[model samples]
Target: MIAVGDKAPSFHLAASRDRVVDSGDLAGRPYLLYFYPKADTPGCTTQACGIQEALPQLGKLGLVVIGVSPDPVAQIDAFADKFNLEFPLASDPDHGLADAYGTWVEKKNYGRTYFGMERSSFLVGADGIVKNVWRKVKPEAHAVLVAEAASKL
Candidate 1:
C-alpha cells in the first residue's frame, strides 16, 4: 500500500459528463482519492455522504474529492445522484488505478475470500506526494478524519 511521502501514481479515469479526471489535472491542488468496494452499497453510501457533508470544509482547505470504484459509469452516476454528491466519481472498471494505488487486494468476508478493494483513502498534496494513507478504513468518521488530516496539511 502507498504511504505518506510517497509520490502518488497518476491516473486518468472516466467521470460524469463524459469527462476524464487525471491526477495531473489536479496539480498544485490538494485532493482526496478514496477507494470504495462498490457503488450503492451501504458502507460506500455512508462514506460518500460523510465526505459530501464535509465538502465545504474540505474546499476551504483547497481540497478536491474524487471517489473511485470498479463499478461502471451508470452505477456511479446513479449513486452520485441518489446521494446528491457534489464530487466526481471516477470509474475504474479494470481496476488499473486501484492496482496502481495498491487499493486492490485479497479480502475476506463470512469466511470467504476474494479479491476486492480494501476501502482506502489517500491524501495527496499539491506537489503530488501522498500526505497520508488510511487503509482498511472504517466507514463512519472516515471523512471527518480525512478532513482533519487535510486541515493539518
Candidate 2:
C-alpha cells in the first residue's frame, strides 16, 4: 500500500457525467483522496455523510475532499444527491486508479474470493506528497479522524 511521504499517484477520472477531476486539480492544495468499495452502501454512505457534515471546517483548513469508487457516473450522481454530498466523487469503474494507489486487492468473504477495492484514504499535501494514509479503514469516525489530520496539515 502507498505510505505517508510517498508521492501520490497521478490520476484523471470522471467525477460526473460531464465533469472530470484530475490530479492537477489538487495542485497547490492539500486534499483528501479517499477510496471506498462501492457507492450508496451503508458504510460508504456513513463516511460520505460525515465528510459532508464537516465541510465547513475542512474548507477553513484549505482542504478539499475527493472520493473515488468503482462505480459508474450514474450511481455516483445518485449517491451525491441522496446524501447532499458537496465534495467531488470520481468514478474508477475499471479499478485503474485503485490499482495505481494500491487500494485494489484480493479478498475473501463467505468463503468466496475476489478482487476489489479496500477502504482506504490518503492525505495529499499541497506539495503532492502523501502526508498520511489509512488502509482497511473502519467506516465510522473516519471522516472525523481525517478532518483532524487535515487541520494539522
Candidate 3:
C-alpha cells in the first residue's frame, strides 16, 4: 500500500455522464481521494454524507474531495443524486485505479472470499505526494478526521 510522502498514483476516471475528473486536472491542488466498496451501501453512504457535510471546512483548506468506487457510472450517478452529494464520485469498474492505490484486496465475508475494495482514504498534497493514508477506514467519523488533517496541510 502507498504510504505517506509517496507520490499518489495517477488516474483519469469518469465522474459523471458529462464530466471526467483526472489527476492532471487537479495538479497543484491538494485533495482527498477516498475509496469505498460499493455505492449507496450503508457504510459508504455514511462516509459520503459525512464528507458532504464537511465540505465547507474542507473547502476552507482548499481540499477537493473525490470518491472512488468500482461501481459503474449509472450507479454512481444515482448515488450522487440520492444523497445530494456535491463532490465528484468516480467510477473504477475494472479496478485499475483501485489496484494502483492499493485499495483492492482479498476480502472474506460470511465464509466467502473475493477481491474487493478496502475502505481507504489518501490525503494528497498540492505537489501530488500523499500526505497521509487511512487503510480500512471507519465511515462514521472518517470525514472529521480527514478534514482535520487537511487543515494542517
Candidate 4:
C-alpha cells in the first residue's frame, strides 16, 4: 500500500453521473483516497456512510474524500445515489488505480485464494505527497480516524 512521504500517482477517474474527479484539478489541496473491496456491501456501506457523515468536518479541514472500488460506473452511481453519498466514488473496474496504490492484493477467504482490494486509505497533502495511510481498514468508526488525521494535516 501507499505510504507516507510518497508522491501520489495522478488519476482521472469517473464519478457518479457525468462527473469526474481529476488529480490535476485537485492539485494544491489535501484529499483522502480510499479503497474499498466493493460498493454498497455491508462493510463498504459502513465506511462510505461514516465518511459521508464526516464530510462537513472534513471539508472544513480543507480535505476532499474520494472513494475507489473495483465496480463499474453504473454500480458506483447506484450505490452513491442509494446512500445519498456526496463525495466522489470512483469506479476502477480494471483495478488499475488500485494497482497503482498497491491496494490490490492477494487474499484467502473461505479456503479460496484470490486477488482483491485491501480496504485502505491514503491522505495526500496539498503538494501531493502522502501524509498518512491506513491498511486493512475496519469499516466502523473510520470517519473519526480519518478526521483526526486530516486535522493534523
Candidate 5:
C-alpha cells in the first residue's frame, strides 16, 4: 500500500455530475483520496456523508476530496444526488485506481473469499506527497480524523 511520504499514484477518474478529476490537475494542491467498496451502501453512505459535512473545513484547508468506488459513473451520480454530496465521487470500473493505491485485495465475507476494495483514505499534501494513510478506516469518524490530520499538514 502507498504510505506516508510516498508520492500518490496518479489517476484520471470519471466522477459524478459528469465531471473528470485528475491527479495531474491537482498538482501543488492538497487532496484527500478515499476508496470505498461500493456506492450507496451503508458504510459507504455514512462515510460519504461524514466527508460531505467536513467539506467546509476541508475546503478552507484547500484540501480537495475525491471518493473512488468500483461502481460505474451512473451509479456514482445516483449516490451523490441522493446524498447531496458536493465532492467528486469517482468511478473505478477497472479497479485500476484501487490497485494503484493497494486498496484492492483478497476479502473474505460470510465464508466466502473474493477481491474487493478495502475502505481506506490517503491525505496528500500540496507538494503531492502522501501526508497520511488510513487503512480499514472507520466510517463514522474518518472525516473528522482526516480533517485534523490535514490541518497539521
Candidate 6:
C-alpha cells in the first residue's frame, strides 16, 4: 500500500467531458485523491457532498480534489452533474490505478464478500509524494478531516 512519503502512482484516466486526468497533470499542486467503491451510492453521495461543501476551504489551501471509482465515464458525468461536484471524477474501469494505490481489496457486506475499491483517500503533495492516507474511511466528517490534512501540506 502507498504510504506517507511514497511517490504517488502515475495514472491517466478518463474523466468528465471526455478529458484525461493524469497524475503528471497535477504537478505543482497539492491534491486530494479519493477512491470510492461505486458511483451514486448513498455513502458515496454523502462523502462527495461533504467534499463539495469543503471545496472552498480546501481550495484556499491550494488543494485540488479528485475522486476515482471503477465506474465508467457516463456514470461519473451523471454523478457529478447530480451533485454539482466541481471536482474531477476519474474513471478506473479496469481497477489498475486502484490496485496500484492499494485501494482495491476484498470487502464484506452483510456476511457476503466481494472485491472492490476501499473507501480511501490520499493527500499528495506538490512534489508528488503521498502526505497522508485514510483507509476505509467513514463518510461523515471525511471532508473536514481531509481539509485538515491539506492545511498541514
TM-score winner among the candidates?
Answer: 5
Every candidate's lDDT: 0.92, 0.91, 0.94, 0.93, 0.95, 0.93
Candidate 6 lDDT over residue span 72-143, tens digit each: 999999999999998999999999999999998998899999999999999999999999999989998799
**Model 3 ranges with Cα > 4 A deviation:** none
TM-scores for all candidates: the values are 0.96, 0.96, 0.98, 0.97, 0.98, 0.96
> How many clashing pairs does model 2 include?
0
**Model 5, runs deviating above 4 Å:** none
Candidate 5 lDDT score relative to the true structure: 0.95
* lDDT per residue (tens digit) for residues 1-153 in model 3: 799999999999999555798999899999999999999999999999999999998998899999999999999999999999989999999999999989999999999999999999999999999999999999998998898899899
Compared with the true structure, model 1 gives a TM-score of 0.96
Per-residue lDDT of model 4, residues 8-125, tens digit only: 9999888876689899999999999999999989999999999999999999999999999999889999999999999999988888889999999999999999999999999999
Off by over 4 Å in 6: none
Q: Per model, how many backbone clashes are there?
A: 0, 0, 0, 0, 0, 0
Name the lDDT of candidate 1. Answer: 0.92
Write candidate 1's Cα lDDT for 1-153 as tens digits: 688999999999998546689988999999999999998899999999999999999999999999999999999999989999989999999999999989999988999999998899999999999999999899898988998899998
- Assess the local accuracy of residue 132 in candidate 3 as a C-alpha lDDT between 0 and 100: 92
Displacement of the residue 134 alpha carbon in candidate 2, Å: 0.6
In model 1, residue pairs whose N, Cα or C atoms come closer than 3 Å (at least 3 residues apart or on different chains), thus clashing, are none
Taking all chains together, the TM-score of candidate 6 against the true structure is: 0.96
